[model samples]
Target: MEKSLIKPFIAKRVAQEFTDGMVVNLGIGLPVLCTSFLPEGIHVTVHSELGIVGQGPAPDEANADPMHIVDAGGSPSSIVAGGAFTDSAESFGLIRGGHVDAVVLGGLEVDQEGGLANWIIPGKRMPGMGGAMDLLVGAKKVIVAMEHTAKGNPKILKKCRLPYTAINCVNMIVTEMGVMDVTPEGIVLREYNPEFTVEQIQAATEAELIISPDLKPMA
Candidate 1:
């Protein structure tokens, strides 16, 4: 697929949340795309589960190396000139120790209360939880990026039917339609695309979304 078809806008927004020298972990799939959107001048440090730290931006097409395997996307990447290796044990230790500043991951469903259900599919019985359970508790901040709806059905629900990996773990969610923050009051609408409305988002979501008074169109 062409990169044009990808909604890096949300990725871009999530990347903006990053700061210089912060350690970030990118989950599989869409979250992996966030690396390509990072501003060139920033020296953000990236980490991968495959035991890599001091990771760099996504490589150019001609530069991409599938063997590198920084993230699931197989984007071109670079590591520290002399990096060390650790087993999943040590890798997870970094995650569980709260060393990760933020995590960007995809989601199957997110409830208004910030409950995240990214694994399993009810009667279907899909793959169970992966690192999400640990990341939820480990990462300082969690940003989820996913489509507002999946195959015309709302992924945001009042209650997750498939199964839940974590309850009230997400800090923010950026969908194709809008951006929402899990506030003390509720899921606050932080931003929305130009073509959508609060009612439109509400209609497409099974969960109750609290529209922020400052809700503005996406810039």
Candidate 2:
């Protein structure tokens, strides 16, 4: 087995998918890392369901504001210039009304058919599905940033074993091994990490993966 890219790099790769001036939501965990890797020269508005938009990266310990600013994950963050705060109702209204251009979320599993499963582990109790369900259905595009597998189990499966968050909602997935796009035909391997080969990725993935005609190195 090869050393796959780390979580931060995977989040960086996913951030490249964002276009200029898009209103994007970063889900908790890996998706939140996307904030630090956003491309330069493009102004993006970052929204959190916790009721803040135009937020920046997590603040340094010394500069952190204990009272006013924090991401949905409860990590201290800085608000970008012109950022505004709102209540949770208005926050979700922005999401459910289709105002968000894109959402990068962490997934426990994603099936070949583009279904997502991340809300719970089935047997264990979860904090509850916060806003993932709303974000999945409301965003103009949904990109999943997560590890390719978990404890050697392929998270990209032919069918998800865990409870699914949404069906056919994932537009693209950026994993440590590669980047895949979900198409009407199936999951297409678009880019792969330099450390792994197409065959290696196929072997690691349980779903039938289609190598894109234009497959390229992830770097």
Candidate 3:
């Protein structure tokens, strides 16, 4: 039997980090799902580098905002309150200037040293990095939410073989199996959702883990 590809799996996990009034930017593609995970009755202002701010999840079909449109990921999105549309130049300033509280980005490979490889892999045709560079540098916090593995093998590695987007930039990682915090000391086990063990997580990881003595299941 095949396993169910959980819809909004990563989205729900990313939502745990969201708080009221967070200035957030979700990377293109999967990271955009965070929009759909917003808690009702709480206002979270989302910023899209695509010249949009105060975005909400994709509008309901019947209640769809003709003017409000979501990205390709089916995430609900809208403009920020009293926001302005500016060119990429000014937009980047918001990122690099540390105005963004947290940014959720996907990754191709992430190492224990906090290096990220999300753009291109050699011998693979992929679009080059654009805003990721600025976001890595500017965002106050960075959370990388992705599947635990790639091609039956681990993408969480001891070191990244592909070219890096940034070093020591990622702060947290949420995998199908668990959550980890990247600290100067090591990758700290924060939350593990599924019924998995530290040994299982270690077996799945390419990097060494510093399991917290007080480790617990993810909420």
Candidate 4:
């Protein structure tokens, strides 16, 4: 598949990480796509930092509610049954209190040490981070969903040159190229994308990686 197909591919893989009865925070952008690909038979409570919970996929053109319903990115969305709305303080309270089971966030750079740099790009003036820093510190599991490289540059780096969003907080990485886990030993390659060779992925990654003994293709 082409690079344009990577985000949703990674999002689908990230969706598999959720289990039944879990409260998950899906960050803006690509992470939001996971809501549309969640596996059947599992009940997940989706949280948005903009103060909404139990959000479903983006609504169709006819069903879109312009005034009241949306995700943090301001995209039109649907709310599930029994969903509740609250203020940002309360929303972050749930996150900071560790009530969240997992958080899937987009990333610009991730280091072998599990450090993340997603907020700023140095020299560019971007809006401040909404709640990613809080989510990184408090979520039980921090998963990053991004492409393996950016403009042909490796995003999995030996060390992030951009400003750090959170240090040593990432637990797993889901990229279009594969899925990897951050282990005490090193970054362990758990699965490889069938379309790409291990050598190709290794060549694209700047960090030292250890392929798992039982490595397989991503489901």
lDDT of 4 at 90: 94
lDDT per residue as tens, model 2, 1-219: 344438888988988887899999988778877867878877689988889889877778999996888878777878888999999999999998999999999888999888999998867957778899999988989999988888888999998888989998999999989999999989999999988888889988999999999999997
lDDT of 4 by residue, 1-219 (tens): 686788889999999999999999988789878877889997799988788888777789999997888788777878788988889899889898998999999899999999999998757857787788999998999999998998899999989989999998999999998999997777999999999999999999999889999999999
The alpha-carbon lDDT assigned to residue 88 of candidate 2 equals 93
Tens digit per residue, CA lDDT, model 3, 6-38 = 426767878878888889988876777777777
Specify the highest-lDDT model's number. Answer: 4
The deviation in Å at residue 114 for candidate 3 is: 0.6
lDDT of 3 at 190: 73
The whole-model C-alpha lDDT of candidate 1 against the native structure comes to: 0.78
Model 1 scores a TM of 0.84
The lDDT per prediction is: 0.78, 0.88, 0.79, 0.90
Question: Per-residue error at 55 for model 4, in Å?
Answer: 1.6
Cα error of candidate 2 at position 101, Å: 1.2
Instruction: Give each model a TM-score.
Output: 0.84, 0.92, 0.86, 0.92
| Candidate 1 residue-wise lDDT, 114-147, digit = tens | 7888878866867667677888778899898888
